[model samples]
Target: MSTPNRVYLARLAGVAVFDPNGDQVGRVRDAVARMRATQRPPEVVGLVAEMPMRRRIFLSINRITSIDPDGVVLGSGTLNLRRFEKRPNELLVLQELLDRRVQLDSGHAGSVVDVAMECSRGGEWALSRVAVREHTGRLTRRGHLHQVDWDRVHGLGAVGDNRGTANLLAVLEDMRPADLANALQDLPDARRNEVAAALDDERLADVLSELPEHDQVEILAALDRQRAADVLEEMEPDDAADLLNELPPPEQDVLLDLMEPDEADPVRQLLRYASGTAGSVMTSEPVILPPDATVAEALARIREPQLSPAVAAQVFVTRAPLTTPTGRYLGMVHFQRLLREPPADLLGGIVVNDIDPLRTSTPLPEITRRMATYDMVSMPVVDRNNRLVGAVTVDDVLDHSLPRDWRDRDAVSPSSATHDGILDGDDE
Candidate 1:
């Protein structure tokens, strides 16, 4: 067999892997490689193949006969049918490296769009170069695609995987949720989902809440069904409700069923309201305390780590049986009011009574105007009986006030002419 000088992994993927005597065995799922310390390319360990019955098995690199644009041909028809288990020293290109963010020595960061493999004189293959593409939005089809030597590009995940590069995930993990969400927005879909999946539930929830509605839908859909429900449960009810609104009824029902009943109930209540109303955008988990509680107690409640800045800025004073939508809406106490007063002073005496609570059905525009007019970071929402049901934080209000299509302004060009060599000429 004539050994090809070079081939692209992206082109190799999905190609039919054939056995000796020209019988098809399976399709190439991924390539495994072990990094090298010297300047030499990382040796191609083997190929992971998906055969009939969706069975994934491994083919040793020693058995590969030829590398060509058509596919990989085996040295022999005999192949192991056992499940493929990843060894600690090996990395799966598709699962761990493809589409990963890589920084070149020139200080420009791009994505590993595809990997280039070359045949050695001794009949072995090694990853030689990586196709680094400047990523754009989902609709943006073409960008600058550079073929850079693998030695010049650093894998950010390698450190986390204890393979190469510095501890990049640790650095990114420290970013604020909004900042992290924005950073993830620029990545390709595969890389974005991989990063999102790596974050912890609470952190992932915070990041998801900060993302645009369309992105929220995409990321949530990418997560495991049970994991998606868990992340939704961690988010504020208002944020969770808004995300759920993006899904079709069938998917929404599936996630809701997976969530704890108590957490799911509030989101359901919010969904019952008109799309752009106070109830629909309000958080069911407001900071509420009985009127008799001391200023000291209120301050402690505000310090809870999970409380958002908007909710922690004040405490609502209510009567007993304090479920969300409490039994009675009495008054409120600003955190400033708590500061000047003695720690032992009961909240009832100094509670501010003049503040008017919003009705559940109050239109979003009115809610916005009221919040602006009163200089309030948050406003209470009440039921028909004047019972406190929830509070609409300023952040949620601001998000709703933006134009519906505001998040979609970044456009992508999908024309094929710009991405040379990335696609097969026959594909057009």
Candidate 2:
């Protein structure tokens, strides 16, 4: 192999993986290592690479002919295509070990910044070195970064707890919220909570909404009550309500009490509606406007960077009081219609109400059928008095429609069943 003797795992992240023909296959997501019961260094086994369509597959160390900052070259193009599942004795270097709090043999306390795997002359690779950053409680002065033998660190044997998340979060900063949430699922319970708590409220809220409900509740429970409530505030009201619904009523009341009343109100309203109803799944904060609002104004509102594509696809035009439960709901104007109309044109003229709006009590199946039939990205939900209460997006419907464990690691992904690639091992 032409690979370097020692390579830091963090630097390998995002490096492209290619076949013998040099065609790009996937990118490195994490490295897999087999752990031992003793203090011996862990053996480097393989890599977890995310292939097309977000399918993560394992590539055995023996299949690689080269490894560098540029890319990892596979000896063969055939990939097993099996979704990577961590064995009980295996550790995911980047996911579980980065930022691990450790105690050096010399009595210095620090956290892991990176781990390096070294290849021996005898043709075996093992985790041999650790880069740790010292822990300094002061904010003004920076801590020293130390490079030491892996055996010198005390905490790598177990998953990290109370570790700094700066290094791990930096690697994940570029990931989309859904991808980040999926990555979070691969981490150990304590490590997941640490990373979740470290994220800013808005980022955490986005990630939380993408996670499975059980994982969402666990991470939330691990946070400080005040912090958790703040994160809930940052999530869409529907998402926030869905997460809260996973908890017991008493616990939900505590978090609700901590949130700002305005943010809590919509969530409370969502909670009152029966499960699987439009009212329970709709977002109370969809783009809303009065019929008199101009096309340009509607365009500008939807253009806000914070709005999701589905929510921004259209605008709900209602009477006085733009907030939910506002005066009579007039109708809605899709962004496409807004673009066709003159900028000065009033939304009232172009507003579309030909398709009747969904009532708060509409069941999930009916809402799904209507949205699909109308080819709508979002549908407005009105109360009995015709007041705009909320709007449900296609994403909401899909989230509810999927099996509860759809996000679990064991869940079968679309491409998981294929095994076009060779998974040859010595035993096989």
Candidate 3:
């Protein structure tokens, strides 16, 4: 007996199907898998074969013998010519599994780029593994495939069943918000929004902050106006402004009206900045504190789990009752300086004037240079009145510097491009 080797689904889809007599009967169209109760990989139930006259038939694995890269060879001389009909518990691999988004237990997610199948010791061909590609774009389609065990994927074998959805969610529940966002974007539109709806406002806001503008808009549009407003409230002013800018004026106005004034004000100010300026991409909320705040007080604010890593590294010192657009921009104190200072000492005495602040109107290139020159991860932005209005984090600056519309482009040609007929829902 020839040992079974793995074959790519894209290459297998159109391979010839032959009977024992060696006469070609049809072309392979798709594979059918039956879900099992246990953790073992799902079993390959049959193959959907397209015959002459455009007639399609289901060839149960029980009837056929070998499935190899060359073609499928049947064990019997006579073939079943009955038209193919999908059974309720059966999953069409090409139509439902391949190229579909799946969540992994590793707190990561990606599309099923391809499948690996092998003939078992018992002589039946079954899916052995799947290739999940994280990046999808012009350059990434031809990219490296991260092969994982077939059992790790959710949303495949148990199609349309609660088990699969539950398993998928279990893997996603603890995923980093940004990682979850990447996973969600790769899912089919309906499934993507379904998952997005399940995330809490704060969690969803964090995910939205990591998503591209187009995806951010799509997810927000999918949400109810009130929920969208709540999520926007949880997002940073700059990220929220970026999302709002992408919406039509009428919709934007409606959403803004639904938001609390305090939350909407900073975003409104950010929306006023021109597209490529400092004010355009700066985060209006940084960790600000009064100059008179003791080192102990500063440490407490830094300890808040909600503060992003970049914002937590430094504290902006402003004149009297610290607030955005404060009475005056005094100076800033780095977190390292705080640990060394006496707990009772005031921040005003420890604040450093070493780094220069960027004006709201500073050009994008100049702002980029300033951050790079000072090796600063977060830089303060001041208005004409010298009041601190925002701070631009390095991540945001890099995002602005990237090619426009980069997010909207695919990382690779879609997996379906190679075998469109295999993906046709009507066929299953």
| Every model's TM-score | 0.60, 0.88, 0.63
Return the top candidate by lDDT.
2
Ranking by TM-score: 2, 3, 1
**Which pairs clash in the backbone of model 3?**
136-411, 136-412, 137-410, 137-411, 137-412, 138-411, 138-412
Which pairs clash (backbone N, Cα, C closer than 3 Å) in model 1?
139-412, 140-412, 140-413, 141-413, 325-389
Worst 10 residues of 3 by lDDT: 412-421
Q: Which parts of model 1 have CA positions greater than 4 angstroms off?
A: 1-168, 405-428
Which pairs in model 2 have colliding backbones?
A: 79-421
- What is every candidate's alpha-carbon RMSD to the true fold? 18.7, 3.3, 15.7
TM-score of 1: 0.60
lDDT of 1 by residue, 1-428 (tens): 45568877766666788888788888776788777667677888777776764455777777778767687889743466655656656667655665567778877766776787777788778888888775555555865788888788877336443221122244355556865675566455766777888888989999988777888999999998999999999998888989999999899999999999988999998888998889888989899999889999999999998898999998998898678878788888889989999999999989986878999899999999998999999998889988899999998887888776444314211221211111222210
For model 3, how does the per-residue alpha-carbon lDDT over 171-250 read when each residue is reduced to its tens digit?
Answer: 45665675566556546677777778878899899988877787888889999999999999999888888899999989
